[model samples]
Target chain A: MRRRTEPPGLTLAERKRQLVRDELGDAALRLLARQGFEETTVDQLAAAAGVSRRTFFRYFASKEDVVISFIGLVGEQIVAEVEARPAGEPPAVAIREAVKAVTVEDFTENREKSVALIRHTLQIPALRARFAERQDLLRDDIAEALARRQDLPEPTPRLHFAAGLGLLAFAGALKHWAEVDGHADPAAVLDAAFTEAGKAFAL
Target chain B: MRRRTEPPGLTLAERKRQLVRDELGDAALRLLARQGFEETTVDQLAAAAGVSRRTFFRYFASKEDVVISFIGLVGEQIVAEVEARPAGEPPAVAIREAVKAVTVEDFTENREKSVALIRHTLQIPALRARFAERQDLLRDDIAEALARRQDLPEPTPRLHFAAGLGLLAFAGALKHWAEVDGHADPAAVLDAAFTEAGKAFAL
Candidate 1:
């Protein structure tokens, strides 16, 4: 923790590295949006980011790795959002808002590129399987988030089913958004899914 | 349709073939339970089933095919059960019974082998992917079942989410059952999951 209180030079260096990573991610997303994942190369991504090929390698092992990393980051943000919700909030409502936050924060800027990246990843069966596994882990994270704020805890079947239901809605929302070619608003889709899910699961 | 009206000889032949297939399947499950998927081979399965290698091939092209076929049958039975529920019944109740019927009808006999089969299949990553895809399709089937029973038709987001939540409980119950080494009563697990899910999703 003390490392965060760095000298001015180290702070600047860290900030610069983060900026380069973000730029490379943006450049890669632009290429993937225009050209398919296959047509985009790491060299082009490096050049577009104004970084050397070696620097690109330092950040992401491969072109696919960047997309995976982006997905991982989005999932983490959702979990964090869920955890950060008001402790008195209802679990279902908190989960819905947490997922809503993901679309707003992650896709508000360069929305088309984000959609294109989602479509690109959905096209790959292996990546989809990996995504499914992460969703499974995300269920655990959501449960932990809920458990932290409530009496539920790990191994609680109630938590498992609730988390599972949350992810099911999430996956459904994503599938619908991608099916519409991502032209429709994803946040709206998520809103629809969660609203429907709320009514569906209730008496 | 006239095939059913065939003479006694033809009818006997068809019945004999089904019994043989069932026997072969049981034998394969027994072997899988005793040894494992990798350790067991086509030849060994055939020998265990007391059938020739060619007969085993005729029944299943591969050892893996048999497992897939079994899983496919279970999934179909679950869908059928859901579809067969009383039209006036609540969607959640119907889904609960449909999944309960799976453990009852499939596990009443040879309970150990059934557990072993589930564990064996879950151990394989490729099979898990196939299972997830099939679960996606099952969601559609559940929606269709609900639509047929209720006034809601196609494109109903409520029906879609209801189906998704049902599958979520079903999957959680299965995962929990598998985690317990399958010695526990699976029907009880499903009961607990649905109950918890109901309480969790409610306002």
Candidate 2:
């Protein structure tokens, strides 16, 4: 009624809640990269963000959860970009582009910091398991996006299978890059993985 | 000492030791299948096999470890059968055959029981994590076997990526079969998954 066009949905409380969550996530990431995951405590994370320890627990269960939620943004980008791809494009090519696009969009800033965060995340077995668990959620989003692009009634087994196959290649590429300490261009490694992926199937 | 042609290398003591382990594993499986994983106790398992609790811990670290070690046989069969596949076959076809072979060679004995075990395993978050942990080892073995068939000097990242892709399809097929309560021919479902896969790649 006041002629406000911005943020048409959120009430005053929801916006503040989101802002606090973001601040905590940013602080959590900074601490994780600098102090390492195991060394970074929740108290320290909250202190960095100017939030109470209780506030931290309200949003995240642990440092691992914060990191997962941070990178979960990339998963969202992948879905949005896949749906953004031309409908006429083949599902495989769309998937490949969608994966690549997430990096370009989400990782445009803090490239080195993001890499450091990821390196630290993978070194811890618990974090890696948490990350692997997150992938299923990503897989579902990818499958749903691919289905909409292909004009299917719903995400069929084929779309889900292809989505999984593509993500596996993406994961492999990430592993290869991470294993080598990221000396090479990770984007190129991912691109190659996508290109050379289905060659096993004579693609 | 009486010489035996069987197990040409293992000493009598070693042979007997291996026998007890297998017997314990069998008992554990029978108990786990009849009773739920959470409901079954190590003491009950040992009693079923007529072995001591000390003997149970002698082989497995925990109940979860026992189940992982049990299903781990399928992972080994996957590697062995993949390596045994004809070298001339495309890596995709070889992977498909290899996955199918594991089920036939291993699951033929107790298909329903195995499925129940898997369902229970998947339902329990901890068991699912442990099972997922075991899969990385299996993936490495698959990469190595595929490399051997492809005549690669080493398991290249590409081989690993392709192996992951193929496995992803196999997993999708398995999930489809499992979701339907294994009411259909699982192998056919897997076959269809593999066949329909890479159709996204313009195959």
Clash-forming residue pairs, model 1:
none
Q: Flag regions of model 2 displaced more than 4 Å.
A: A1-23, A30-55, A176-190, B1-66, B122-126, B179-187
Question: What value does the interface RMSD of model 2 take?
Answer: 2.7
Give one digit per residue, the lDDT tens place, for model 2 in A1-203. 43355465876677889999988887777777777777877889989999888988999976678877766877888899998898887777788888887774444355566666677666677687777666756777888998888687689877776777777777776766666656667668777887777665673
| Each candidate structure's count of clashing pairs | 0, 0
Residue-level error in angstroms, candidate 2, position B60: 4.6
TM-score quality measure for candidate 1: 0.71
lDDT of 1 by residue, A129-148 (tens): 55665666677788888877
Give per-residue lDDT, candidate 2, residue B161.
62
Model 2, B1-203: lDDT tens digits are: 65675477877887898898888888888887787788888899989999888988998887788778866877787888888888788777888888897785455466677677667677776677676666655677888998888687778776776676677777677666667777777778878888877564552
Candidate whose TM-score is highest: 2
Error of 1 at A120 (Å): 4.2
Every model's TM-score: 0.71, 0.77
- Hey, what RMSD does candidate 1 come out at? 6.1
Instruction: Give each model's whole-structure lDDT.
Output: 0.75, 0.75
